[model samples]
Target: MGIKEFMISFIFTSILLSILFIPTLLTKSFAGIRPSSFSGHPQASPFPVSFAYLISASKGDLESLKRTLCALYHPANYYLLHLDLEASHEERLSLLKFVSAHPIFSQVGNVWIVEKSNLVTYRGPTMLANTLHAMAMLLKTCKWDWFINLSASDYPLVTQDDLIHAFSSLPRDLSFIQHSSHLGWKMNKRAKPIIIDPGLYNLKKSELMWVTKHRTVPTAFKLYTGSAWMVLSRSFAEFCVVGWDNLPRTLLLYYTNFISSPEGYFQTVICNSKDFKNTTVNHDLHYIAWDSPPKQHPISLGLKDYRRLILSFAPFARKFKKDDPVLDKIDREILRRNDGQFTYGGWCSERGESNATCTGFGRHENSGVLRPGAGSRRLKALIVKLLSMRNFKRKQCR
Candidate 1:
């Protein structure tokens, strides 16, 4: 095609996507009930809260990313996937194609991709920036009770229906963020160091730069650190994205030079903001097992962890190897998902022999269709423990 024709076609596609994709992200929350009224035990209510997910992936992770998205899919939730700039164009294109062409995704219209990939550096501000970008996009486009951030290495231990059911009774204002005021060793190492992530500016990827001069810890606000993964309320997500109070933006600039900014940025912001500090529940809601004497990263989960994985009853687990046998085990036992099939939910009629696997073929039409499994009971137990008076009130901003 000629340049003029291609330009016109691109403009038409952009307009079409703006109409089709943006509004589709506005998922129905709590099956049409207000979030404030969603509190307390509502098991028979049949109304489940909605979640907005930002799932990130890096180079050579197309398969893992696809699997994670497939396992986490539910018609009630809105998903935004990102393949970082480091991935080859062909890989990104392949992922876009997968999302666009998936029968269920096309029908549900709940999945999206960050077509303009950002360059992210490990332990740098760019990683946090990438997450913030996703939050802004989701906040503007969707109305969800909670926001969840995960990576391709992470997979769900519970199906989406189980997650929705478990979280349905919980207060929508709560943010399940794992945080601690006691920085311990991080105070000197992470707080004092001045590191520069080239990914923030340069188009090409490079190693992080460490400045020679060290700085003193600020007295303006105390530094808190914790796990990068979190489940945030829409209110908290909006507070961070909007920065109306200026605290989130101030910390954004302060964390630009800090090591592993993602681990500390939201923690610092939420703890310092008194309005939301009381809403904190010090659990990331993920099952992550670190190595003995512990390294920087957690140990990859395997078949051996299956027993503990079930016992933990957390909604998600992390750092699994690509195409691991244990993932298949989780798919079969916990998620009830078959190879190449979407996770089962009540919204869809099952297909194949004995109707074992769910084929997510249609939309919910605003009211959710949830089929809670054993995983729902397991997760509800964990949620009870986390929200218990002894566990819930004592850990805030600490």
Candidate 2:
């Protein structure tokens, strides 16, 4: 071939390659780069306070888990998702992929998956263990004011902005846990029975194994029980995980054979410890609707329960059906999130020419800014009433 012909062919090939690679280059450029906030600033300020969340899910709850994560996600907070060992391999893998692929999660680097899953048994100490496990991981890896344990079946009634804003002025050492020394029927039904959890030693999941012999109630520590869900202050979480004092560890052994240990473990621990007992706020901060008589589980909420749930002024609610219509109402009204997007907050803002919001990195300087809405006011009112002298002192360790 002639030299001229060879040179012309080489130039044309180079042009073709550049054109093909332009899209690829554009996509790669955004990798790990923080997106700009809506104000055209590089990022928005963070909220004054933050929460570290442990979101636990069992088999067949992948969709609900994803929805809950999206709704609760905020750049300032940390999240650890735990899919029970009983969940299918596909479900666990899909959840991991969703967290990894999420553009905002990748950049913020706050979301995590408990790759080493635990076999959890309902109403057993294993449930309590899972909560503690996540707490330990979060304590080791992140710094936050509070640790919130939620299940896939639960949904947020307020946005992260509203939550942070409402909590900003409150005492930092306070723990929002519902507890009472009065055990009622649980004293006989839950405490007396000695049971074993197979999940502790076996690979398979099973119900608690009841023993023929019953044990007397203890004098070492008072037994307290209430809702399993809670918002624990970092100081209290450290006490449970670190156990500088042996109370947390001692009670853990006692509750090992107790029924529904998750409901009592933290409650008993907080109430028994002098350092943290006064910090207890005696509210779980979740709105749960019980049946007329109340059963093993709270009733699954629907559109009909929307008003009551909102008026309750709780930040979170539980036992919702997957993709329930009431959740849609929350997205449209309370959260201002459309279709599976993150709830609106100061750290994230809508960018022009892009449908995505909060898919950006926020500057440290922008931290502590809040864009709280009506939900914030409602939550503030609830907090005020709870912290009132009549309610706060009257409800503690009663």
Candidate 3:
């Protein structure tokens, strides 16, 4: 069915859920829904990390956002989904309905929506602002360890259980961001330019305008740049937003006029702080392919890139075309996710016996249940390689 029809159907479904599911959700008695144990499984791991996800989307991306939400959803995780101001109110409502109507999501009550949306300019510092806004909101609402930022074009390469399982054994303070201080050509093209984002004040969409005057690089703190996407630790996010020290606050202001601020803001802040510099893990945790002598954008992943995507051993990949068949294959094979259902995880008990089977939850429903699959092995391999003394220590903000 088309998106409109799907949404209309979902609205009715949500109404029914409010009437039907409220009782099950309110009771303290329904507790046997979680997995019994995680003794020994081929895919099991010992990681106990809880991830907080900030998923950002814009106009014409509702469908992809919904699908990505399901693919990435897990009970142990906290989710904040934002549809930027560019999207229509109807689109935002549809997304809200989908999340609220879902039985498991309503029951768990872990998902959130940013009702007051921010206007984001493409390739502007507003993207960084939006991320920080969500990060701040998440910090206030829940106590989670890692904060993963994703876009509508990105999809999970593994289940949340796998992700949580794999992360359980690792240090809590590590941040997975692809970064380098080399700057190379970007020094002239990005760092030297002073551009003003029209979205900062304009209602209509417009390209960023550059001021004729060039700006000198700040000697106050070293500038580092990297991929906009990252999996950040809660401690580091606190350091950035709360600014117990002045480093994060100072860099935020410095990057206000910086070109491609999303790529530089977090990088510079994390690297400049002596306390956080050593906590960096220099990978974006995504499998993204650039064209030879890459263009402004990474190549949109399609069926042709499937083999490489799986082999990359990364837990996420990006820039996929909407409704790409590769995504369908990922949903079916990798995530074990049906069209509108969450990815298979220990929390989903209803898939086995009854409609409410996976609905089983307890005060500690997320205690020690990780059913990591092949993707976990892949991610684990990459994590292992990254944490190895030589590669891990040598690549930090250098």
By TM-score, rank the candidates, best first: 1, 2, 3
Full candidate order by lDDT, most accurate first: 2, 1, 3
Q: RMSD in angstroms, all models?
A: 9.5, 17.0, 11.5
lDDT winner between candidates 2 and 3 = 2
Cα lDDT tens digits for candidate 2, 148-204: 999999999998989998898989999999998888888789989877777876789
lDDT of 3 at 154: 96
Query: What is the Å distance of residue 326 in model 3 from its true position?
Result: 0.5
Clash number for each model: 1, 5, 8
Q: Cα lDDT of all candidates, in order?
A: 0.80, 0.80, 0.77
Please provide TM-scores, in order, for all candidate models, with all chains considered together. Answer: 0.86, 0.86, 0.85
Runs of candidate 2 exceeding 4 Å displacement: 1-45, 350-368
lDDT of each residue in 33-53, candidate 1, tens digit only: 122222222232344678889
